[model samples]
Target chain A: MTDYTPYVAAVYGLALLVYGGYTLRWHASYKKLERQLASQSQESP
Target chain B: MNILKKIQPLVGLASLIVLAVGLWYVYQAPADFQQGGAVRILYIHVPSAKMALASYIFLTVASVLYLWKRHEGADILAEAAASVGAAFTVVTLASGSIWGKPMWGTWWAWDARLTSMLVLLILYKGLMVLRHSLDDPVKGARATAILAIVGAVDLPIIHYSVVWWRTLHQPPSLAAGANADIHISGPLLPPLLILSAAFILMGLYMVTVKARQIEASRHLDALEAARLHHDD
Candidate 1:
């Protein structure tokens, strides 16, 4: 009908931002977890 | 190598490949006759919607396992899936609303599918609050598992909402039929498929990472508790 370019951009942009933000958070948390586990294991070892 | 070490590379690489290929397809796909450029929203909307449902299913199964066997890891997995599922649900609802405005002439309707999906998000948030509030892990795990199990009743309602009720939303084209197959048609299929795969890969990576975070948090919390106990 009308130009749906904005709607398309909004959806895709939102998707990219959400996925990217979450992935970064996941990576950071994973690194933190690894460090925690390492320190714990070292203490016990 | 440890499990995380092994999984990290595959997860990272797969997600990148999926994102690259999926976006390439999105760029190349043709416009729909009816919805025109707005149809692109389908790539994200449909996949995230389905993944939201898929995540809930995974959470339900994991919750059942936790309840049945009393395994802490199962509880961790269930909780992780719930968190990811909630995130996906927001994407689905947001994209759907944005797309619906021009297509359906309204941002939202109090339709069955939408309502049930909202309920699912609320349930997920409630579970997160429950997990954090309860000091007793054993009691909390059991309670949350039961809540997850009960919450699963919404899944079928969300899936069949269009068919079961008169709604603005269309019924699913989940399988092959004489007139239809996948919800997407023609050139849109390639990009949509690639994107769907990418979203699923990313979802797996998120869930696994979240599960590990929960476990690590638990360990750190335990250490904190023990240190405090010693000081006392």
Candidate 2:
């Protein structure tokens, strides 16, 4: 009977924040690792 | 190109597109007669809850593969799944609590379903901690895998808790049995189903990205150790 637009929006907003934050963090970590591995390979020989 | 390079981009793009479409469906669906706009929360909450359990099952299976075949890749996958699973569980609990506040009139209750789901979140966190606690990588993987296998008992318990005990939580929504109560249909069901698929694809993409990160980390560790040995 009550409008719960705010509650529904909060859940979707939270989902976006959590998933987006995680994706960006992991993508950045992977890129850093890739760069490190590339540098190491170059230094090896 | 390697298999991962070929598949990861497509999977990532597909997840995003499907998730957008699923959101569109949710937006277009009419409000529930009883719960009004609040029912929209079910679109995210149900899929997240399902994915949380699904991810643990994936981790358990990967753990079995790692233990049976001595596959390092499997261990990496299990690790990736655990992290992703933990994220989904957090979403599930937080979203469920939001929904509960309006419907159940409380933030949380010590019910079987809710408590078991909480236990599942704990198990996932425990597995991650156990994996990193040991100095020896092999020993850490072994202990984590064993714990994963044993912790899988909670999966069945989580699934059946509502049916087995009297609880404030509602019975199964998608699952069918004597205890099944919710029969969502017409405009309401499509968004839920589509979002579930979208969540699975998104979960898979996250797992793959994490697996690559873990693989790279292990390689770096090995290289560092080898250099140390050579210098010594």
Candidate 3:
């Protein structure tokens, strides 16, 4: 029987890492765009 | 009333919850099964493969919409789905290989299922390349739409490859008969379902966000063009 614990941990850890990295990147990009829009709106006024 | 705006945050929260539950299940998995703890890799690998298949389906539908309706949103959705689908395909292959190393005593196989998945990955990459090669947005959309539709022909073959060929990979038990090969107990089933749901939701959220970014970039370009025209 294969000892599955370490492999399982690695798989789940990788998934979490990918998803977390994506979330952080998405949040940062959205925030940067929001800031740009805000500044644009202020300039227009 | 604004459904699209509400989807992202909701999906993000749901994905996090599902991830948590999936981790909990992994922690609880038995240590002495025939496959050992490596069986836990199934949670991520299987779900990602499913997502990859579903993503192609999404691309096909969106491609049809773009061709028939000439809708920019549909075209953008197809493009976004291609990117996510490609990423999921990579994840599926990576997790599968990792699991295979210990179980099958090999890291790679040229079986039909694996080969078809590799083809899908290549097709998706081609679509992305086509999307970037054209300068005109409309032309790029049309070209990629055609590619997406053509690529979807591989999905069914990929799904049935194990059944049709002599292969190292096992046929999908989930589709053959719910309880045929491996029984998913009460504890594991809920989290598996939740994680699958979460991944789909998150995928949709990412696509929408990407589409919005594309739209914003287009708007900025248009504004720049208008300013130059006015100055002229």
- Which candidate has the top score in DockQ? 2
- Comparing 1 with 3 on lDDT, the higher-scoring candidate is 1
TM-score (all chains, Cα) for each model: 0.87, 0.92, 0.82
True contacts kept of each: 0.74, 0.71, 0.38
Off by over 4 Å in 3: A41-45, B157-188
Q: Per-residue lDDT tens digits of candidate 3, residues B82-114?
A: 877887888887787777667655677554555
In terms of lDDT, the poorest run of 10 residues in model 2 chain B is B172-181
lDDT string, candidate 3, A1-45, tens digits: 545567767777777676566656656775677577667657654
**Candidate 1 structure quality by residue, lDDT tens digits, B63-112:** 99988898777888888898899899999889878877776667885545
Evaluated at residue B173, the lDDT of candidate 1 is 33
Candidate 2 overall lDDT versus native? 0.84
Q: Ten residues in a row with the worst lDDT in model 3 chain B?
A: B173-182
Candidate 2 CAPRI-style tier: high
TM-score head-to-head 1 vs 3, winner: 1
Question: Which whole-number lDDT from 0 to 100 does residue B172 have in model 3?
Answer: 58
TM-score of chain B of each: 0.87, 0.90, 0.83
Give the whole-model CA lDDT for all candidates, comma-separated.
0.79, 0.84, 0.71
Query: What is the model-wide C-alpha lDDT for candidate 3?
Result: 0.71
